[model samples]
Target: MKQIVVIGGGPAGVEAAVAAAKGHSQVTLISEGPIGGRTGWDSLLPSKVWLHAAELAGVAEHTAEGVAIGAVHVTPTEVLNRIKQVAQRWSEREAQRLQAAGVKVVHGVAAFHSPHELIVRNDDSQQTLTADAVIIATGSVPRFPPTMKPDGQRIIAPRFASHLNTLPPDMIVIGGGPTGSEFASLFSRLGVKVTWIVGAPGVLPMFDPAAGAALAAAMTAHGATIHQVDVERAERTEGGVVVTTADGATHTAAMAFLAIGRVPDLSRLNLAAAGLEVGANGQLAVDNYGRTVAGHIFVVGDAAGGPMLANRALAQAWIAGRTAAELSAPGYCPHTVVSAVYTVPEIAQVGIVSGGEGELQRVRASYTASLKAYLSDETEGWVELIYDAVNRQIRGGIAVGTHAADMLAPVALAIQTGATIADLAAVFAAYPTLSEVVFAAARAVK
Candidate 1:
């Protein structure tokens, strides 16, 4: 049997280790943190809990007719504790799953001694391990721009959210991506003054500009101040924090949340020893199979460096793990992945490949067209489907509003299956639902 060593204990690493073991390989997973590591503990799962809280708060804050719902109060300590408990339970379960998979787990710091060799060190002992294949899923850390660094007090990162025993009266959120936009939407809806600064003209640059624009407008309506400019520097004051923009303007808030994006944490890995050099891309580049230039080695997840998305990491882990154990891997198509941003009115999209050489039609429909939108009182959103003129197929789609992700589910599957417009138009939702808005867009294609 092959000996496979996977580094890091995040979702990606654990999945890879289990996958390799299932393929009849002897798998060893080396991690320096608790089960689930950064993803389950501090980053992905924890942030979602906070966002879910924000979602609930948004609903309660809306006063209903003939209702006596009192003012909703959020205690920071309770929220912090709740998030920890949820994350801990999930992490512990993952630990049990890893053990059941029969993959040896090592809690230690790992550094590459050679392409096929690793040196792992714990506080009390150091050991060396040899493997036929090495998968590096060593997650990522928030990347701080030259002049903007979190001080753990007035200025903070999402990872420091556990320390949030008190929500600021006002906060500035930097970075226009999913992390920044979500928090901006969350805090503002929760009645905290929010100043969100985006380097681009709008949020969620990866999605359609219209979706970002709609989200930004909603945030503004929820009492957030949006600054569509780059931030030059941020510093703490006697009472608050001040952020200077690239345009020389200044904005102040009681606290600053730096969602400035993340980069792989490979500083301690000593990649040079393994003959891996992180070049102009600022990361060790890998192929679609998750294999590095050094064929026997692979890097997946945030460490592989593209978008820090869990779906992408999971896919890469499956492919790399199976391949490492000499088993066939179902090839991954980067384009087939769908992404969703969990703001109040969410955004979801899939960028399908354009059918060979023909016009692309963007069929649009408003939430007003859906009976469910009226039922949910969310008749303000929209869905757009991309129709390939040549193939007469529903190639891709985007949604913005309540249950946007749910509405886009069929579209995403359609894109993957290369479903024609007629195929999608005939797809039934069975009821008056948000997905009908997406179907309405497809049926509108003429």
Candidate 2:
């Protein structure tokens, strides 16, 4: 059997090890922390739990036509406890999964002993191992500029979100990307005063402008203040944190969340010994198989550096693992992956959100046209589609409302399959469903 080594235990690394083992290869996984890594414990899972709680809080505040619910109260500590329990359960299950797949698990910090070897070390022990092929899936950490540093208290990062014992009365949110937008929306629902400073003109700028405007309107209606400017500096004071803007204005809040961006955490891997280094793009680029310049070394997920999402990482991992084991697998286009922000009246987009370098025609439909949306009191949503006018083929689409990501998924399929507008418009959508809005936009394509 081929001896394969996988470094880091994020979803990508763990999946890669399991896949390689299934291909009749002996795989050893070296992880520094729990099996779930950042996604299972720190960033994705815990954040979802908090967003769910916030959604429930909104449900308890209003009286439905046939349902009467009492006021519900939740503390940050209580949510933190819940997050911890979940992480424990998930980590244990993943460990069992790895064992079932015949993959050995090692706990340590790993570095390259040579291009074809790895040295694993911890405070108490050290070992060297040989590998026929290696997969690197080390994820990233929040990038803090010189003007802002996280103390894990007043000035915080997303990874430390579940650690807060109490919600601040007011917060200053920097960065307008998906991460920043989600946190700003979460605090707005939790009744925290949020002053969002988007370096761009609005939130979710990477998506269609209509989608961004819809989300901004929804958040503003829920008591969040939005600003379009860049932050100059963030400093912690005796009472809280003070943020200065580039426009000569100062803003203060009980907390300042630095949601700017993230940088790959590959420095400890000793890439030089592996005959690899990051390129000019600030990350190591990989091809269809997630392989770098060194044929034996594969890098996936955050280290591959496109969208720092777990689903994208999982896809890359599967391909790398199987290829390493001499198995056959088809590579997928990373652009077709869905991007969703878990805010009230969520935002999701797939394929291209903007029109550029093509003969494209855009069509739009509002949630007001959907009876299901009206019945659910969510008529403030919208959907838009972009198709090639030359061939009437479906290129891309966007959805903003209930289950926005779910609604846009079929469009992603169409783009991948080269389906035409007529193909999607012919698909059956059950009535009183949110997906009808998506179909409506597709049918409207002229």
Candidate 1 local distance difference test against the native:
0.85
Instruction: Report how far off residue 265 is in candidate 1 (Å).
Output: 1.8
TM-score versus the correct structure, for each prediction = 0.95, 0.95
Pairs of residues clashing in candidate 1: none
Tens digit of lDDT per residue, candidate 2, span 1-446?
89999998889998899888878789999999989998888898888888888877876775458887776786899999989998889899889989999999999999998999899998889999899999998888778888899999999988996797899889998988888988999888887899999885568777777778888888888888888888889999999999998888899999999888887888899999988988887799778998889998999898777688788899889999999998997785866888888888799888866756568878888887678887777777788887887887777888888778898889888888998888887876888787888888877765
Expressed as tens digits, the lDDT of each residue in 1-446 for candidate 1 is 88899999999998898888888789999989898889888877877887878777766766455666877876778888998898889888888878999999998999989878899999989999999999999999888987899999999988887667888889999989998988888788777899999885568887778888888888888788888898999999999899999899999989999998888878899899888999776689788889989899999988988788888899899899988988899776665666788997798787653344458877889999878777667888898888777887777788888878778778777777888888887876757877777777778877
Best TM-score among the predictions, by candidate number: 2
**TM value for model 2:** 0.95
Stretches of model 1 off by over 4 angstroms after superposition = 63-68, 352-358
- Could you tell me the lDDT of residue 411 within candidate 2? 88
lDDT, each prediction: 0.85, 0.86
